[model samples]
Target: MGGQDRESDAWVYVVNSGVLLDDAFASLTLKRKLERGRVSPENLPPSIVGRVAKADGPTVEAALEAAAAAAPVWGAYPLETRLDKVGELLCRRLTERAEEITRILVAEGHPVVLARWQVSGMLECFGPESLGFYRSQMHQEFRHGERRIQVRRCPDGVVCVNPPQNAPLSSALLGVTSIMAGNALVVRAPRSAPLGVMYVLHEVVRPVLEEVGAPPGTLNVVCGDPVPLLSAWVESPHVDDIMYFGSSENGVRFQERCLTAGKKPILELAGNDVVVVWKDADPELAAEALTESFYGSGQLCMIPNQVVVHPDIADALIASLVRQVGHIRPGRPEEEDVLLTPVLRNEKFFGCLRDALDKGAELACGGHAMQADESRDTAGIFLEPTVVVVRGLEGARDIDAVRHETFFPLLPLIVAERAPDEVLLERFVAYVNSNEYGLRNSVWATSSTVVDTFLSQVRSGGLLKINDSHIGFLPYLPTHGGTGLTGGVFGEANYPILRTSHLQGVSISPGSRPREAVFGAWNALLPTKVPTAFPTTFPTKRSQEF
Candidate 1:
């Protein structure tokens, strides 16, 4: 279904609630450049990937209107019913079409493995563990004799999503969680490459929405210039929240706009993640895990941006990492093992490499442009997976490659100066937390003490991995998001279903006067017996003293 056998002018459907509308593609008016490939997609071979309809600002307004109309009815469904009906079905759809969707992601310039990884994350997000956690986080009931008190989450009325072009389908997965929140969703697909996201909404999400007899406007998809759509949403009263994805700097500004408009801003911004390798770590295994830095040419926010190695084993780790990187060469995106993709404009990559070199960093390996076949070529479409070794924690972040988030295949290995293990560990923790951006922090260590030290002391990133793949996603763990610059204001471990909703405390009492309920409810408490609904551990009416 994701293949290019269809005509070049593939039409992307605009779904309003559960109804599919054709001609969502603007005819004759405009068909933008293919957005499938990374960097400058226009520079690549004329792709079989189809053109997107650049819907106008008015279309975005209409989509928002439809979502606003549908949200109340959708949100009224019992949370359990919504999870069982829509969430359950979406999992099945993803499982059935995993291969096809993977291909579409590859076609959109993601490496094959990254594509599969994204698919796996989607499955895990809807897995049994995550669903159970969602139930706990979304709703809880308490009973005291005839009175019932409930604390539950309510869907934000209408959610507007603007997923980054780098990984639209994965980012748009946030919108699916919005659906579970009982919020109606509107997604603005990236105009550069709208095909993958367009495909997912129809084949995966829309059918489930329809099967459940959801409001026709429960979910909507539009592809166009982001400027118009974003401006329209910020000004529109219908948008309750805008899930904007972009650079951290821009996202911080967008956050202000959302606050001014009384709209919640759920941002998935830039990430400068970190990994720590203690002296006791396995060199080969550590090198293998560090390869995640090269995935998607290091474009993704979750990839390990920098690695801090204990000075005692720094040299060995660097050697192993250089060998591992030699195998991660440039090739076609569809290649089973290809990790490198084209970097159409590598000025920033070279600039960072040069700046680090000038500042006394040693080039470990790979700081050049290369052809698809891994041959050195200045004009090649791809850049080698570059690694540089920056010594000492003192002024380590002064280098751009270490300080800023990189969108290319540039990884810096920071080796702190040798010191006593205790002092070194404290310094490492301090250095890690000093990072302005925090999306993830992974540690590779054999000592339980060392791992525990990092776990207890280090306070950076939204998620952490210990002796596991840094970029791998797991059920019950937050799959995306973080703190500091990565998530702008109001940032934490972001679970879309939770982040997009608000909690309300509800209590229902029968045969009670208003004054008694408000002023003397505790004084008029019933017998000191736990309700039948609650188990033995549940609390019962009693004196204030334990």
Candidate 2:
């Protein structure tokens, strides 16, 4: 999904008490602009942007209350039963409604192909087989000679889901797995990209939720200013967990609130992912991986924000990247041929590019802003796919381009001038780790030793892709979350089904040995033992006797 212009509408959806309510007391206006640079009014669609009604505090509270009331019943249900019945049905609905959802995404400025891909990904994640790993992770049985212990995980009582504005459908789709783990959820539709997410939840998933005999309040969707809704969830005593996806600035603050309220927060915050290219790495492959920086206009959390390359291959890698970038076409997101979307922040893009260049970095290619024309004419939304090269670390680290994350299509490449040595490797690794945001990082190297060192030494992102694309979402593996600023306090790969729950240890004592042991320990602690029917053999030898 992408940003769009906002227009007012009368539609309001609040899923509460197992029903979809249309009580929109307050409203939020969002925009969806198709043509950039003040497109001729005649060419634009009549209603590209629209507004969504907001849920009041009491309404949100009611939703949470209902969810709390239903949590026990849902949480007690069998995991496999929920996955097979609810998950499978939701997956089918997503597939059936894929085209409709894709159309909505396209209308919101997502590319036709990319929109389809997004829906496809959502389907994959919703598929029954996708959550099979959590079955074993959530439940385990063990036994010894005399003791039988069953170590299993149970869902957090109630989860309040606040997915990111970008890719809301896929992100909120994670709540399904939470349900599969037997937890009730209240998912907030993305304020910016609610159309697709709303369609999936209301049209596809809601029906199955009701049909499967999922208790009322098991699932709720509220649309409004996130501040109040989140506060309500935090204040609610019954809410057990909050899954948040957004910037570190807001996320850190929310995490604090969650901690203060004694609620678990599963955060998927910002990422300034880094990529390292060793001297022996394939320039073409490195370029391919780094090119992902342009994906989603570089707005993605997993996009490669910075590249650290050996000087020997830095020039070659830059050349390959420039060549690859030349093929990128910026146009309407609904077009099949367009690879780059209009950048939302033109000033920030140019400002970052200017700062990098002023700091002794060279613009390898496509750094300047492009003028709007008939074919490509989106103002403030279209930036040339840019690649900036920093020959050394002197002025690079202080520059905003390298130091901070700009959600624009800009890739900053830093050159390690020194040869590969323990000292240089250590310095480079430190540099990569210095990035405050850690979501995912990668190393492009042919040498097993270099790869191993990079893996073992670089302690940055939650995920380390040896040679894979930095932005691809591998559903089977953990894709969201990271360390440092990416996830607060508790940072790791976010597996919602597992992370939204806690482990519970159950021990079954087959004999009365435990009772006897407790009695003996109590008797030893007490000077006078009450009359209890328990046989205790005195030790044959004591220290004094010996």
Candidate 3:
């Protein structure tokens, strides 16, 4: 999924998959440049449209305004009613447009099957699944003699969302949870990945907003330089909360800017996820699971970057991993099973791999960029899954390839000496949980005790998986963020509702009463007048003076 060539036309019409946009299209276009070279005249495949729009500014702003205006009415309606209109509409529209959306995604850079799965998951999350979770959150109860209060979830007004560029559909789903939670949103779509959201908003959300009488500014979408948009939103008095997904370096900078501007920010940042392979782990299963860590060219925040394996099974695991690595083939985005996208396959990734090799890391399997057998212009980005066997953890430490995140297909495998299973497990857990960046962690273990130990000891990541798929997640299970650098303030748990709302405690009384009197009795029991016992001190002082 590489970038599209620049268009030279002033008025560009982005269409859905297989749908060409003529002048008759009803979609809104806020800007029209007329200069001869103002805009590049490029014929972009529909699949790449979703990723390309992340950089459009006017489009995002308009969407945000619409969402903001609609928030009050949406928040005021009964949860069920709101779900029926907005959530249900989103789901239905997504289903109807799934094929087109998936096609667009494939054109942009994803495998068709993966694109379909991405769109399908987004639809399910906005449907009954999300509605049920929100309804459950609405239930209220109180103990005897306690104040009976309705835990009203009020909208937080205007929220700004910055979606990740890699998984455009999934990133939008992460942001949609906040919208479902009653917050009006101004989403900054991945400038490069705008088609998916465009289809969702234009086909699904717009109709719901119009039918349900959502306010004019309830939701908006913009694409452009994220820094300018984020800066403007953070500094704007109208924007109440900001949800961001990006690298830790970028996330930290955003957090600082928000603090400076006196705005609240919820961040989902980067991670160097760690996967541990124990002696008893299934080598075959472990090898299969490792594929997820390399998916999307290892650009995802949850992809495992380093593997710590036990020596007893390390040799076997390496063999299996290398064998499986050979099967990952590079192809066009429309290919049904193509797993990798052709983006960022340049000197930078090659440089990183070369540096790793120079640092004494052994390349166990694949380690080169593959060009498709097609027009050079259409060659897809393909990197061999390069696995590096490190001498030890000490040698791995401080290595940029191991410590930092690189959006490339590079895996570092560290083999540890044989020890008690319990000790090795504890050490592995500690290492994963101790990293400053905590997004996700995966472990391969057959022993229940080892699993339990890992679960208990691992504390950094937002999500933990035991013998299961890493990136495969459900709607109820938040798939976006984590702690520390991962999500500075907003965690990637099923708490989008919380992120989009503020809390306020209220109490009521039937009659006017002295505010201090309510606690006066308890206060009086302490000591109203405690006299210091003199014990004839005055007489003793007088005698001493005499």
Model 3 local distance difference test score: 0.67
User: Candidate 1, overall lDDT?
Assistant: 0.81
Candidate 3 is scored at a TM of 0.81
Cα RMSD to the true fold for all candidates: 8.7, 8.2, 8.6
lDDT of 3 at 270: 80
lDDT of 1 at 95: 96
Q: In model 2, state the lDDT of residue 48.
A: 38
Alpha carbon lDDT at 541, candidate 1 = 53
Q: What is the Cα-based TM-score of model 2?
A: 0.84
Better of 1 and 3 by TM-score: 1
Q: Give residue 6's error in model 1 in angstroms.
A: 20
Total backbone collisions, model 1: 8
Model 1 TM-score, all chains together: 0.87
Model 1 stretches with alpha carbons more than 4 Å out? 1-47, 512-546
lDDT of 1 at 377: 90
Off by over 4 Å in 3: 1-68, 374-381, 489-494, 506-546
For candidate 1, lDDT tens digit of each residue in 229-277?
A: 8988999998898988999999999999999999999888999988999
Candidate 2 lDDT over 1-546, as tens digits, reads 001112323243211110100111111111212112233333322343433545666667777888888889888777666666776787788788788887777766576766776776676676545656666687888874466778888888899889887678778887667887888888888666676666676677767877877887887777767888888889989899999988899899989999999999899998888899988888998898888888777877888999988888888999899998876666666567766665545887877788888888888887665642324334434677888888876567788888777888889999976754666677778887887988888989888878888878887778889888776656566767798899888988777888888899987767756544556545656738653435455566784386
For each candidate in turn, the TM-score is 0.87, 0.84, 0.81
Candidate 2: C-alpha RMSD after superposition: 8.2
